[model samples]
Target: MPSVPPFPRASSRTHSSPVYRQRIRHTVPAAGCLAVLLFLIAFGSSTVSAQPADPAEHVSSTEPSTSSLSSPPQTIAFTGGAWYDGTGFVNDPLYIENGRFIAERPASIDTTIALDRHFVVPPFAEAHTHRIDQKGTLEGAVDAYLADGVFYVANLNNIPAFANPLRDTLDRENTVDVALAHGGFTSPGGHPQPLYERLVDRGIYSDWTKEQLAGQAFHAVTNSEELRTAYETIRADEPDLIKAYLMFAETKNASGLTPAVLAELVEMARTDGLRVSVHAQSANDMHIAAEAGAHQIAHMPPMPFQHDDGEKWYLIPDSTAQLLAEREVSVVTTTVLADGFDDGERKERVRSIQRENLSTLHDAGVHLLVGSDTWGTGQNEALYLHGLDVFDNQTLLRLWTDTGRSIFPDRAIGRLAPDHEASLLALTCNPLSDFTCVEKIDLRIKQGYVIELPPQTTSSP
Candidate 1:
């Protein structure tokens, strides 16, 4: 078992709800990468099962395997392509050595792939999403993301039971690299509570009891004391980044953390050197999160909420956008989520708000990241934003590539430059002229290795 962090002792509160006090039991076996491969080879199914009666019996004590380290570095050359260099595409022959772009050509080349004058761009990234977290959705989601030319993903809120096993499986040559925010912090019975319960109701997690799922799904911290207690589990979970939720902060009895509590949580996360991504559901939520020193706002306040006075228009004030821009906190564009609203009038209303908010944020110089935050990849979000006519093709490209990669700053990816990770997508048409051409991926390359997909899906590198 991993040791928990020793946080400073604080006064306690007696909470009756299990979501607030129940200690999480990490039931997933830590067998790591080898188990994933073996399981796939044996069952050919991506859905992982719950641990057996003796869960500890299967936890492997060995170190996770690093297949890339033992293999000798290979040199590959991509010729005759117009690669995007941040601003625009330049006709240049790119070289790769040991899974990274190289300025100097190697003496010996292992293979040469001709790009056939295709448009080469850094692979797309998802800054905020939960599509790749669950076992039932993992395999198909990965295939869809790669087929759409998206190579980087972030699982914003997931349980360790499902996410921990795949920690070693992703960020490899063949799979989409992921950054997991295992179990977000939310108010008791807040946004994700209903989300997870619906999954169980839909038989997506039929085997899981609500009690077993609640503790693993989210930390229900309402005050400073609750925040400190949750830190113990935060350390145990070892999240890549901290996740905070702020919804309807202006409401009288909203189901979210207070401004003071959120500030405390942000301070703690900053002290621990972890970036914080806050889920903001409304303009007030976004303002509160930015003021609390959140590094990223997971959403652009896409949906409107019923205010205390029954107003539904959720528009971000110019001052709030300026604050976010001044703080340099990137906001993810999940405006596509509003497309699924059943009410046509409500959908149009939400879309109007999204367009206004996006323009405001863009004009204020606030960085925006591309993310669908739905079952699909970031391509859909990119298309939606393009349709809004706020951002040009080049700006959207940079947001999906460069800004999106900022979610996981530790990785050297999302750029077609020397010493950057050698992952790119080749499209048959110039995406700059026709934005739709981005969906037409001709070839995919990841980590200096050729990636082969099914026919009509994508070609080999």
Candidate 2:
């Protein structure tokens, strides 16, 4: 057992200077194998010790508590593997027990199942996936992630009602590390207005083509009281973090959250101990969110807003960079999301916008966490392609795996250190040397159970 869990708070940490990434190190827990049907059936359960019932009944409580408690949770160990060691990825032996890494060495491990001659990377995490839950049927789409080495997620807005079932599965089955947001905090009319009926109307404009929604982004919040109430309602769900809505510049009818209102929402969330993430479409919204002291800003500001008052749209301005550095606002670089092409011209525009923003922020020491929003295809998954130029493959893999560790400070997940989560993916070639190697997974081990596919087999139907 670890003397204590790492609690560095991976949300985002501002650095004094730019730092390149290293490889990933972690053990696969049951959470990593949620999609592996074979693994679940073979090693679904884990046993955690319980306090003795009473001195008279159990005496010293030293019976090891085997029976009644169920089988121990499965944990996978990757021996003779190379992965990120925080500063970079390296080849090393790894050991994991009960979903956590307990040890790693330079030589062979005594385990029967060895991950020799494989490139083990941390289980990938889609930081901004839509909400998912288990229905009664075993054939559900929830496991889509585990099949892809996704152990953790930052869920987008979904019904608060279904959080429990997913949480139960994650807790009991060790299937996923899910951090959900209450249904989105949007302007009176935004993305939610279309996806959800109650949220529509108020000129949210559902009739728009997919190109419009994709270009426009989510709704913008106009009313301060409504923003306050919405934040409260979502906070009541006890989410790991808060989601905020910023307006699209084109939606003049959609009044963006003013600095005061954004501050109000931030304050309310503060009292309740919630971190805020803003879906800012422009720089003004981005500024409001930062000024309000929100913890995480979800996107890279693309174009400059260029308000009549000289305010700009979305961008990581030098001033904003300085401010973010000062206030510690970590930006989730979802560049992959920009891959959507309205057409040849629009696709080029969006891609260009993302590239500009990304290069600037990266150079500015902004806390850049690599996320795809990929699980749902909002942004495609990262391997050697897509985000390669902006973020090197090695850097992307490291941040995707380690940065999602918003819960702990550089936990065992991001590095191949002893006593970390044994959640790993093995590649045919060294990804550190070439990011594309990640695209060629040779083996995957999540919490002691293999998905049983030839390195390239599908984990899903």
RMSD of each: 16.4, 12.2
> TM per model?
0.81, 0.69
Give a tens-digit lDDT track for model 1, residues 1-461: 11212222211211111121111111122222111100011111121121112322222332122111111226666555678887887766578887789878876554455554467899988777887776555656666676777788888888778777766556666567888887788899987888888877877764876776655788888888888998778768788888888877768767767778888988998998888898887877888898999999998876533322322436888899999999998898888887777777777777777888899899999988998787778888888888888878888887888854686687788889899888888776677787877876666778775554433332111
lDDT of all predictions: 0.70, 0.51
lDDT tens readout by residue for model 2, 1-461: 01111212211111112122212222222222211111112211122122113222421232211112212333333434445555454554555554566654323221223334455676666566663532332123334454455566776555555454455444212244667765666655455555655323333333434344321233345677566555555555667777776665334644445556667878877888777887776765666677889877776655222222222354457777767767877777666554443355555555665666667766777776655554442224464224547776555665666665763333545555566655567665566666655445544555443433222223422
Best by TM-score: 1
lDDT comparing candidate 1 with the true structure? 0.70
